[model samples]
Target: MSRFEKLSHVIWHCQYHIFWVPKYRYRILTGAVANEVYRCIQIYCGRLGCEIVELNVQPDHVHLLVKVPPKRSISEVLGAVKGRTAIRIFKQFSNLRKKPYWGNSFWAKGYCVDTVGMDAEMVRKYVKYQEQLEKQQEQLQF
Candidate 1:
């Protein structure tokens, strides 16, 4: 295969799992707060030139399935998404302050990311079913 063909044929996809503490996992991601965070993430991901295929925003954590260009490093892509979102979230929702919501940070220290295979259909299915899996877990909890 030609170099251009080789490059064009390759596709890189990743799933990122991120967490945030509500001053210690207090579950502060409610209606408005969650919405704001989601919006910020959308913009941040767009700016980073990554496509957010799916997102599951829970009360304490978030799951994102993103497709990034092969030229971008995983760490750089995650940093852009996480860093920009954190800043925008803190700015838009001041209640995240310690005096209001929490003091120090919006997201936790680290994130989980994994690579997905080139099977596009499988990736699509995984993203689509993520919410159902969460619901099943919730049902089992009670």
Candidate 2:
């Protein structure tokens, strides 16, 4: 009845707030691209036995609230999500890897990740509030 995931020797709730952007911080993650990135991340994380508690794919970046297992290091989790998503996105949308970009890389080299434990609600609200604020900013520009 407990919420925490239980391994043979451990019971844990390792949630993280992960944010990463596209190469050059391009606003390429829109419409189909955003959907694809979200789907790919969900699939990849699921394969790793990780649970995505919340996710938001912004125009230039992505924010994910994921529950990772202790068996996998944070770097390993990021590698899997970012690496696999990049490959799949490039393959599905060939134009992304062509011309001026001159490379198949999709995500930037680094990411920002923070632990979301007792303060999970605060993080969730912050993410939601950010999206709302961004929306408002866009409205003002037009």
Per-candidate TM-score against the hidden true structure: 0.63, 0.80
Per-residue lDDT for 1-142 in model 1, tens only? 4212124667444444433343356576678877876787788777777677787777877777776666777778767766776677778766566355445566666677777554788878988799889999999999
Error of 2 at 46 (Å): 0.3
Please write out the lDDT profile of model 2 over residues 25-132, one tens digit for every residue. Answer: 999999999999999999999999899999999998999999999999889989988999999998999887885773768889999999977677888999999999
What C-alpha lDDT does candidate 1 achieve relative to the native structure?
0.67
Poorest lDDT segment (10 consecutive residues) of candidate 1: 2-11
Identify the leading candidate in terms of TM-score.
2
Off by over 4 Å in 2: 119-142
Q: Could you tell me the TM-score of candidate 2?
A: 0.80
